[model samples]
Target chain A: MNRVSAIDIRNVTKAYGPTLVLDDISLKAEANEFIAFLGPSGCGKSTLLRMIAGLETLDAGEIHIGGRRIDEREPGARGVAMVFQHYALYPHMTIRDNMGFGLKNIRMNKAEIDRRVAEAARILEIEPFLDKKPGQLSGGQKQRVAIGRAIVKNPDIFLFDEPLSNLDAALRMRTRLELAQLRRRLNATMILVTHDQVEAMTLADRIVVMHDKKIQQVGAPMDIYARPANRFVASFVGSPPMNFLPVSVSEGANGAVATLGDGSKVTTRVKGLTDSASWELGLRPEHVRVSDQGLAAKVEFVERLGERTLVYARLGDGTALTAEDEGLSRVKMGDTIYLKVDGDAAHLFDADGKGYHTPEVG
Target chain B: MMSPKARREFGNFLFVAPYLCVFLWLLIWPLISGMGLSLFKADLFGGASFVGFENYSRLLQDPVFLQAVGNTFYFVALTVPALAIIPLFLALMLNRATRTAAFFRGVFFSSSVLSVTIVTLIWRMVLMSDGGFVANIIGFFGFDPIPFLSDPNLVMISMSIITVWWCLGLPMMLYLSALQQVPQDIYEAAALDNTPWWKQLTHITLPAISRTVVLVVIMQCVLQFQLFGQPQLITQGGPNGASRPIVLFIFEVGFRRWDIGYAAAASQILFAIILMVTLAQYFVASRREGRGR
Candidate 1:
C-alpha cells in the first residue's frame, strides 16, 4: 500500500489586478483524507485547488505537502497530480501513452512506465481501450483515461478540478461511486473542487464551503448540512434551500422568543442571543409540518414529486416558505394551511447573516 | 417536372454558376489551350503548325533551361525551410495573450498586405550594393561593401532573403490561429506532467498542429516553386543568368524570344513537378494521420 501524505495550506491569497479571487485562507488535510472545496460559480474554489497543485501562482502564503514547503516548486516536482475538468487528454496519443506520458517525461524506464500504466488502466477498467486514442472513446472512458493519467504518476496528492462535471447524469452517478471506491482503495490525500454540493457532501471526508472569495464553513458533510455556519451556506448547501422569514427576537427561558412577520409568536431553541431587534427565522422544508395550530400560510403552489410533495406557501404578510408533506396529500394552489414550526429544529440569523443553531432534540 | 428537392438543388447550382463560368473560361480553357499550344510551333503572329513533341524534346537538351530549373530548385531549398521554420517561431512568440504579443503579431503580419512589386522595390533600396542600408551597416564593421544583387553568388541569397521577409506574414498568421485553437489546459496539463517548454513545443504543439504544418509546407512549396518576382524585379537574372528561375526563363522564351510552344512546354513541366510534389505531401500527411489514429 502507498503511504498517504498530509497537506497544509497557510494564509493563501490570490488576486487578478483589482479583483480579489481568493482571500487569506488556511486549510489542513489529514493523510488519506478526501477534501472537497465546494462553492458557487466564480467563488475561488477551483482557484484554491489550482494553487495547491502549483498551477496557479499565489500572491501570498505557502503550501506544504508531507510537511515540505512546495509553494515554490514546479507542479510536477510538487508531488501532485491534477485531473482537469475537461479531462485534457492528449487527443493524438493512445490511452496507454497518455497515462505513461508523465512517467516517461521523468525518465522512468519503459518497463516500469508500462507496468504503472497497465495497472492504472486495469484499476480504471480502461484496459480494453488502452490502444485507442481519446477521440475514439466515449465521454466516461475518456474521463477514466484522464484519471488513469493522474494515477500512474503516483503523486503524494491528487487534485481533482471538477473531474466529473462533463459526464451525463447517469454516468456522473456511476463515476462518482467509482471515484469514492477508488479513494478508499488508493488511500491517498485527495482534494476535489466542485460547485455541486451533492458531490461534495457524498464523496468528501470533509467539505469546505466557500463563497465570495472566503471560506464560509469547513466541516464533515452532515455537520455542515445540519448546522450551517451562516445563512449563505444554509441556503447554498441544501436542495430547495432553507426558508427565511423576517422576525423580531426576545429573550426566552428555553431559547429565544421570536415574532414572525405575520405577528405569529414562535419559541425557538437557538441560544446565545444578544437581544437583536430584528432577526431572520430560518427553517428547513422537512422541519415544517402541516398541523392544526401554528403559523397560518396560504399554499401558493404544490410540487408533487413521486416520493415527496413540496408546498410553496405565503404567510399573511407575504413572506414565502416551502414545506414538505406526504406525496399523496391533496394540497393545491390557493389553499390556506397551518404549518407547525418545530422550534428545536429552527435556526436564527442576525442581520449580518451569522447563523445560530438550536440544540439537538432528544 | 422537377421535385422540390431537385428544384432546391438546382437553385444552389445557380448560385455557383457565375464562378464556374469564370473558372472554365479563364482557368480550365487556358490550361487545356496551353497544353495544345505546347504541341505546335507558334509565336506572336499566330501562324501555327504542329510540331510533334519537338518543343519537349529540345527542352531536355537546353542547358540554360536546365540551369534555370536547378536555380529554381536551389531557391526552393533556401526559402521553403525558412518559410516553414521562421514563421512558426514568430507565431509561437506572438501566441501569448498579452498586449505586446498582439502588437508584434500586427507588426509581423503587416508586410503581407504589400504587393510583390512594392516589396521587391523596398528591398531593392535596402539591398543596393553602393550606399545601401545593408552595405553601409556592414561597412560600419570595417568590412568591404558586398555586392548584393549584382554578384552571381549573392543574388539568389539576396532574392531569397527578400522573398522570405515579404511572404513570412501569411504563414505566421496561419500558425498563430492554429496555436490559438490549441486549448490552454493541454499545456497546463503538460506542465504539470513535468514536460519542459521545448518538449511541449515538439511533442504537444507540433503534433497538435501537424495538419497545419503540412498545409503551410505545401502552400510554401507551390509558391516557392514558381519563384519569379524577386529574381526578375531585383536581380533581373543578372551576372550571367545565375539567379534566373524557371518562370523567368519561360517569360524570356515566350515573350522576348517568342518561342511560344517551347515556353508552354517548359511551363507544363514546372506545373507537373509542383503537382507531383503537392500530391506526394498530401499522401504522406494523410498516411501519417492514419497511423496516428
Candidate 2:
C-alpha cells in the first residue's frame, strides 16, 4: 500500500435542468483516507460521486486529485475507477476479460495485462470463476469481479456508489470487510456514497454527513456520534435514534442547568451565566437513566432487546422521550418511572436545530 | 354423466377446434397434398400419372432451376446482411436523435405497411429502364441511363436494395427495443475504461443485442429467400431468367407451364431451406440459453 493521492473538491454545484440538485458543496479527502458521504435518498450523494467520475457534468466548481485538476477531463483520462451500485460488469465478457478490458484497450503488453488480472483475481479470490460470464455468476461473485476490474486498473482514487446495497445481509457484511481490507492494501483515497449509516460508520476514516443537498457535518465516526454538530446528525447517525426534549437553561456550577418538564433540575458541567433562550436537551438512550430522585414520567411501551431494554416514556407535559434500563430490568409498560439525564453527556440545541456540546477534557 | 374435470377439458378442446380445423385445411392438408402431387407427372387440367422420383431427378439437371437456386442464394447473401445492418445503423442513429427520433422511426416504418405491389411500383418508377427517376438523375451527372432492371447482374442487386429499404422498419424497431433495455451505466463504465466508440459498439452494443441480431438475420434469410413479387412485377424474371429465384421459377413452371410436379418438387426444396434456417435459429438460441445456465 504505497500510493497516496489526495482529492480536493471546491465549491461544486450541480443542477438538473431547473432543479438545483447540489448547491455549493465542497470537501477534501486526504491521501489514503476512506471517506463516506452519508445521506438518505436523493441527497445528491451519488450525483456528486458521478460528477467526480465525469459521468455527470459539474455545473460549477473545480476538482483536483493529487493536485491536478480533473473536473473537465474525460472519464477515461481521470486516474480513477468506480464500482457502480448495480455492479455494471459487461455481460458479454468473461470475468477475466472484464477485469483486463481497460488494459487491453490501452494496448498494454499481453503478459503484463495477464499478470495484473491474475494478481487482482487472486487478491479478490475470484480466480476460479474468471472464465465465466457475468450472467453465469451469482450476485456476490459478480460484485467481486466488478471490484477486481477496479483493482486491476490501480487507480489513485476509488469511488463506490452503494456497492453493497444490492447484496443480501450476510454477503454484504463479508464484502464490506473485504472493502476495508482493500483500503488498507491500496493506500489510495476512496469515496463511498451510501445511505446506510452502519457502512459509513464501520469503514470510513471520516464521514461526510449530507442532507437536503448540503453537507451536514464531517468528522471521525465516534466524534460525530459523541458530539453531533446538529439535531439531524444526532438523530440520523444512531439506531433507535437520539431523543429530544424541551428544557429551560440557566447559569450553573460547571455548565448550564436545565429544568425538566416535571420541574426537576439537573446541573450540567457547561459553564455559562445567562438564561436567555429556549433550548432542547439531546440525549442518546444510553445517556438517560431511570432514577427515583429524577423527573417522574410514565412509560408508554418497553422493548426488551436481549442486550438492553428501551423504554418509551412521556413526561407530565406529554413530551415523548426514550430511555433505557438494564436488559433484565422489571420495567413494565404503563409504569410510572423516574427519569434522569446526564447533563455532561446531553446536548443543547437551539430552535433552528443547531447543537452545542459541553467542552471536551484533555 | 361426465366428471367435472373431463367436462372442462372438453370445453377447452371445443374452444380450439376452429383454429385446428383451419390449420389442417389451409396448412397441413396443402403440405401433404403437395408432397403427393410432387410424386406424379400431373397437369393442372388433365389426367396425371405416377412419376415417383422422375420429376425430382429432372430438376437436378434443369438449367433454369439450377440458375434459380443460384440466384436465390445470391439474393439472400446480399439482402440479408443489408436488412440486418442498415436497420441497425438507422436504429443506432435514431436512438440518440431523441426529439425527432420517433417521427423518423414512423416515417421509415411506413413503407413496411404498404402492400408489396405498391412498394414495387414505387421502386419500379425510380428504377425503370427508360425515363426512370434514377436514370434521369444519372443523366444529369453526364452519363447515360443505366439499365437497372434489364441487366441480369444489376437486377438482383437493385431488388435487394429495394427490399432492404422496404423492410427496414421492423428489424430497426426490434433493435431499438433491445437497445433501450441496455442499462446506460454499462456505456458509462466503458467510457471510464477508455474504450473508443467503435470498440464500445463491437464489445458492448453488438454483444448485448446479439439475440436480436440472430432473430433479425434469420428473419431476413427466410423472407428474402422467397423472392417472388418484386422480380415478377418488375423484372418478370427476364434478362434470360437471371433474376429468377426459386419461388419465381416454381410459379413459372406450375402455373405458367402447367408442370405441377416439377413446381412442387422445387417448392419442397424451398420449404426445406426455410426449415433449415429456422432450425439453425433454434439451435443457436438454445445453445445461448444453455450457456446462461
Best by DockQ: 1
lDDT accuracy of residue A183 in candidate 2:
82
TM-score of 2: 0.92
Candidate 2 pairs with clashing backbones: A254-A269, A254-A270, A255-A269, A255-A270, A255-A271
lDDT, candidate 2, A197-262, per-residue tens:
999999999999998889999999999898898899999999889988888887777888878787
The TM-scores of all predictions, comma-separated, are 0.98, 0.92
Off by over 4 Å in 2: A251-253, A259-278, B1-21, B44-47, B281-293
Candidates 1 onward: DockQ, in order: 0.81, 0.59
Writing each residue's lDDT as its tens digit, candidate 2 over B29-141 gives 99989998899999898678999988889999999999999999999999998899999998998886466988999998999998889999999999986989999999889
lDDT string for model 1 (B14-80, tens) is: 9999999999999999899999999999998887899989999999899999999989999999999
Q: Clashes per prediction?
A: 0, 5
Docking class of 2: medium
Per-residue alpha-carbon lDDT of model 1 for A308-349, expressed as tens digits?
899999989999989988878788899999899888888999
